[model samples]
Target: MLKKLFLVAAAAALFSGCANVMPTGGGSASDAADVAAAAERLRIAMVDPTRPALSTLVADELSYGHSGGKVDTKESFIADLLDGKSDFVTITITEQTVKVVDARTAIVRHALAADTNDSGKPGKVALKILGVWQKQGGDWKLLARQAVRAS
Candidate 1:
């Protein structure tokens, strides 16, 4: 039947997407571990913001999206941290997972709980974060990140 064929095709597409997230050929476990460590370093840098550290961790084409729908480019992201507009007093990442797509790319997901003092006003946030990282030369740099409110 036509309906049955459509359903089968859709299911196949869905499973193929999942296969990418699940670990495939050519990437090793150590690659995942390295990505995790890179993510941890970025978290620490956000808490104690410094331009050098942030610039090093993020790619030139970084796209950072906040839970509130605002997006920041790499320069704006680092500038906000340096200027106290986006300040992280403390950040805790939990239930983190990293999926290495290849020797040069990875995807990371985690639950984030953070205390903030942005523009000198204190606040707290709970978010689900997805980060895409790419290996540049010898380091993994964050290429993009998106955050959504955790329900």
Candidate 2:
């Protein structure tokens, strides 16, 4: 009888441990919100001139297109931005939509208006931009960005 009781107690303990190990759905909403916030923070960091470190928000392997052409790396892209290579660097996001693709991935679609300091003025150049973000060590980083002129 003593051995049977011990076996039952051990089985209960094993089952309880398994239950604790199972994934719970309760924190998903909070997790999604956190991901979205991280993405937004990256966007804000990119535009702040004082904080050049925010440039790291972009991944080493980023892709982007502008009035001049397409760029396939963070270094080249930043070089162009700082060099005033782009005709206009004005980017105003009118609308933004964010979707969480996974625990560490998100996609943001932004309706933007852009104009170079020289050629076209504000409101003349408009585009839609699709940005992909990935969360790494609690901070969100931009993995890719592509822009298409709005019709």
Among the numbered candidates, top lDDT falls to 1
Predicted structure 2: lDDT: 0.57
- The segments of candidate 1 whose C-alpha lies over 4 angstroms from its true place after superposition are 1-23
Instruction: List runs of model 2 lying over 4 Å from the truth.
Output: 1-51, 67-69, 87-89, 118-124
Each candidate structure's count of clashing pairs: 0, 2
Residue 62 CA error for candidate 2 (Å)?
1.2
Residue 13 error for model 1, in Å?
A: 37
- Measured by C-alpha RMSD in angstroms, how accurate is candidate 1? 14.4
- Per-residue alpha-carbon lDDT of model 2 for 1-151, expressed as tens digits? 6985575356434333322121123324445455445444444333432236446577766777654466557787666555544344544555665566666777777676755553233335678878877777776677888878788
Superposition error at 107 for model 1 (Å): 0.4
Give the alpha carbon lDDT tens digit for every residue of 1-151 in model 1: 6985575356434423333233535567767666776776787779877888799899999999998999999999999999999999998777777788889999888899999999999999999999999999999899999999999
The lDDT for every candidate, in the order shown, is: 0.82, 0.57
RMSD of each: 14.4, 17.2
